[model samples]
Target: MTTLQNEPAACAHAELAQLRIRVIALENLVISLLADTSERQLAIARDMATYISPRPGFTPHRPTVHAAAQIIHLVGRARHFRPMAPSRRSR
Candidate 1:
């Protein structure tokens, strides 16, 4: 394949790795949130909405809500356990 053709694959691999890291982070956040998933989701939704549809006042410049949802979904599907949350906790 030509260099031009190979460029897409390299870019995809880099993108995938970046996405994986993001997914892992999201999963950990979710697990920490635990049964409070709704609160966690609402927070993410608010942040994302502010980013995508900035208000008349000061607003965030983050990605859209859809993007956040996608990341959450990927995390749920890809990993069984969160990386940061200690597997064994002390009393």
Candidate 2:
């Protein structure tokens, strides 16, 4: 072919090559972003799971002395009350 024809063809080929390279780079960038998003989601899921999991031990609702006194008082009150008649126990 003549130089004029060859020049245009070469320019078109170069442009097509550059476009292919850009498209490949864009695809790689998109894939990388998706992977990053997936990693972030997994980390969030793990954090939420940890947050929702039950703890190992119990917690007191009141101070130690007050709670102990309340328990003793209730037990003493229970002992003072009697439900059965004397005859039932004698039988």
Candidate 3:
């Protein structure tokens, strides 16, 4: 009886672990895609972060604002992975 009771919990734990792995993989894929984008596109994405920013004041919804901030943070992190352009003086 104890084993049967624990089975569902174990299965749920396994499923949660798999979901975490998938989320990490998706995040890595997005970072790679962002890294490959042109500078112009990256700049546009940075601009989008600003657009998503919540205006200062009391608000009923907080999760939406937090998610937007997270997105902005992710964009900033992905930008760090972008390759630096070679200087023209190197030619």
Off by over 4 Å in 1: 35-91
lDDT of 2 by residue, 10-54 (tens): 999999999999977865554444344444554554454445444
C-alpha local distance difference test of each model: 0.60, 0.54, 0.77
TM-scores, all candidates, are 0.37, 0.40, 0.70
Identify the runs in model 2 with alpha carbons over 4 angstroms from their true place: 38-91
Which candidate tops TM-score? 3
lDDT of 3 by residue, 1-91 (tens): 6999999999999999999999889878878888888878877877776666666774535776676676667677787887777863355
| Candidate 2 C-alpha error for residue 15, in Å | 0.2
Please give the lDDT score at residue 19 for candidate 2.
Answer: 100
Q: Point out the higher-scoring one by TM-score: 1 or 3.
A: 3
Which candidate would rank higher by lDDT, 2 or 3? 3
lDDT of 2 at 31: 42
